[model samples]
Target chain A: MTVKVEKIEGGIPHNTIMVAGLIASVVLVYLTYANVLTGTQYFAFFGGLATVAALVWGSHTIKHLCSYGIGTGVPSAGMMAFGSGVIAMLFATKYGIAAPIVAVILAAVVGAILGYVANNVLNMKIPVMIVSLVEMAVIGALVLMGYAAMMSGSFELSALTTGSVSILGLSLPSYQASFLGGALIATAFMLGGIAIQHPFNACLGPSWTQDRMLYLAAECGFLSMIAAAIMSMPLISMGAALVSLFVAVIGWYYTYAKYIELSKRDAFSWLDSKPIPEVEGQ
Target chain B: MESIVFGIGITALAGALATVAGAAENTESDIGSQGDPNSQVQLAPQMGYLHRIFNKAIAGEPPAWGLWIALGAGIAWAFMAMQVNPILAIVLGAALATFVQGVYATTAYLGRTASLAKFGQPVFVDVLKSMTTVTMAHAFVAIFATVTVCHLMNAALGHPFPLPLLGLVWGIALGAAGSATGNPFYGKERQYQNQKYGAGVPIAASGNIVRYAEAGERNSLDNGWFSARLGGPASGVCFGLIVFLELWRTVLFEHIAAGWGAIIIGIIIILVFMVIDRYIEVWARKNYGPYGKPAEEASS
Candidate 1:
């Protein structure tokens, strides 16, 4: 007749587990980075590992303990920081040393620190204003650091990303293939994120909204580097282009559409003590 | 000076309203003290409205900050598209904005408490009926205020693509989608929610903070079919459609002006609905509130 929803005396054990998970996750990431086979073979090889890692080691299992599991505001914000770093690496590195070394290290370090501080120290219970502050800091840091990284190297950083980058790898038969691939992948990522979040919320009491954001981040993690090869014509083939197009399309859907409240997976957020106030100054 | 002045004005108004309403409720509660246990005089119906209004009016409050955050996040998020292709930016921004809006709204709704609502006379639902009046006030202020500020921001930034007009369009476009995002399944017995422990109130009724707080005292929150879908990803698909149309018009057609067009469409929709409906017109009239049906109702 009466089932009381009890708050766990400030839930000490649960908070410890969460903090431990963050530390463990950041550390284990070193292993994911340790073995990176270069080339198309590497895509299937290490990319497979990353996905598996996300499945086994990432927040999926934690879903049992947490109402939100991987889908939550605190987790989402953590992923945003980590994901931003990964995306930045995707842009800055040659997919050689960057993916293997720099990206993983930076993601683990920056993400864990931000996560620990926000959840544990600052008690990230504030409104969305902190998100803006976090974004500005992360992006601003990335841009400045990335600019320096680009400058130290002889290549012009601006020129590197300009539309002129040559399309290498495989070639597609027709433009239709590229279009078709993009559309299909976009749907998969969008639907996949939704699908994952759906079953998760059923299991975890919370909506698990972070799952959608994380999946989007993971998808973008690898896709950013080889996108041009997938998009360019003459060199772009239906298969590779499909790969590129789908990857791009999915990223587009998740970042824009699915990332919004459409799924409600991120519904139950970390209710911290002090709400983050609106930023009054730069 | 302007920001501080506005903040003080809003804070004072909210305070004044709370004082008058709380006093009025107190006087009435004292007269009727024999029956109701809610005479502690801690919570006030007007205070609920005030809490909400302050959150809305604060310069960096969710209502106000959401715009800048949404806009900035939208534009920066577009960079992810740069990795994919130029066209993906528009698609990404719309979808992202939609999701953010949905999550915040749903999150806001679910956290509301119904037990707080019942602590008074002049039933909370009566206050809820007046939502139309307040929502209209806020919406007009939001629209003109948003459009004007957007225009000014555009001028400040050198007027890219009709400048402030884009803000109006962005607002309307968001508002319309806001309507859709706000719509979803919720209820205690729903399979997705798996209401095992006697179904704690459906998460959708959170939109009505008054009912949410007051109803917390009883077995309530059985808002039926509409509440169940409130948190589902179906809203995502709806967001996709909006993003697609806007993207095709603004990015693909190369008619950047079309970006503002959605605002016109949003305005027309709101106007039509306003003309036909009463207080129920502005909100989805879900016939339910979000916070587990005021606390006084049955657990379900």
Candidate 2:
């Protein structure tokens, strides 16, 4: 007799999840611009929400692409998405109010071309490769811009490139504190790339499910947000940074609990193994 | 206007340099059996079919290239600040980076092979001595070209990003392009050549690499020769075109309507590629006649 194992599956369709995440992120990220217009950084934490949404979309796309059996290409795909997306994001920041929109367009173009090359030129023969790449690229750009807005309180080119420090209760320009000038953009790139890729990498297997992966993705996003919030302390107001941190902690807790609950539900059995007992000295 | 023209010129130069870098980078990785394919090489030993293959996968291509380019650019940036000749500084920095890469190749090859000694895989010192230099030479060419492209973007084009950051971004891009577009030719075609062409490695055949070459037992050096003909150049064009088109659009259209022109052109470019990609996919499917089986068999 042969025994067959079936993968357990139940969740919202991936397309619906992707579209919802995309729309939510784009709207939430724009709120940062509105907050900037009000000359206060209070709503800057919207950027963290936007990042979580984008990572959710991105992790799903990664799951879709890696299903094609591109052996060990999972992390490479994530890095490629961010590598190209970053160029688009940096370029788009020059446009004041339209930076986010321009970034999406630019990233889509870059991602589409990469997909074309991978399919036609390299002949990878994966059917959804092109569309998956385009989505990954846009998600990557959104994540970067979101984190940039979170830390710098704006995504404008001047805001990203200029530094500021408080000297004796007065704000003053200082190159060392700037995002680009201080090489903080590199940190953002690594943080965003890991957050987008790690969930799928950690959860992928024969029995992997979408809900668990996405929940972990959100948890990773919030963890990254906490880091960005800490980094933002040097760049934005202390009150704004603390608020971002508070929100990130709450998001992280909710997602972490959900992920654990899902793991228990999907698991065939669970053993709460304790630490090995120490032997007495001989 | 002059700056835009200069930017266009710089973009062209950077594209040319990137092409060389991409080619060299892919060839070097293929020769060393680095990145994802290194797993197969490692598995070959465990499965009891181990010849001489250089396994120098310290990390994936992106992070490895990121560290190398960042180091090169950092050193070059410092020297340029001290008023050294830019060309000399770049050469010195690339040489130093190449030395570090060679050291990594040596240790990785020795350590991984030594660990597999229980599986009867011998640590070939001669293979290590010879291949390390070849990898280093290719690494130097790739590093030098990438660093020059970063310098052109930062110093000549006046891109607001610093040299090291530009290096990191472009370095990761180059590595990604090579890993995505080139590795299959080495991993599937070169290493698993005994399998029928276009039929991917099946699960049952994992770790079963072709151990013999046309003349004698196969090795990583043989893989290099095969990948150089197609994989290396293909990766070059992929990366080179990405850099060229990205800079080209910005140079030609960035100023119009507050950079909206570039956005519009970018959309047009994507639509064109979408059409081309669809055509290619259909053509490949018709010509190749489905992956693993004949048309009649597949239909049945």
Q: Calculate candidate 1's fnat.
A: 0.00
Q: lDDT tens digits, residues A107-220, model 2?
A: 999999999998889887678888999898898889999988998899899988876766667877867567777566775676677667766665654546677778878877
What are the TM-scores, per candidate, against the unseen true structure? 0.31, 0.55
Superposed model 1: Cα runs more than 4 Å off: A1-46, A60-92, A120-122, A125-202, A205-282, B1-300
User: What DockQ does predicted model 1 obtain?
Assistant: 0.01
- Model 1: lDDT of residue B242: 45
Model 1, span B171-274: residue lDDT tens: 43433343333222321222223233443434453222222222332111222122223422233233334433333333223333555664565566557656
As for candidate 2, its interface RMSD to one decimal place is: 14.5
Q: What TM-score should be assigned to candidate 1? A: 0.31
Best lDDT among the predictions, by candidate number: 2
The global C-alpha lDDT for each of the candidates, from Candidate 1 onward, is 0.30, 0.78
Instruction: For candidate 2, write residues B234-260 as lDDT tens digits.
Output: 999988988898889988999999989
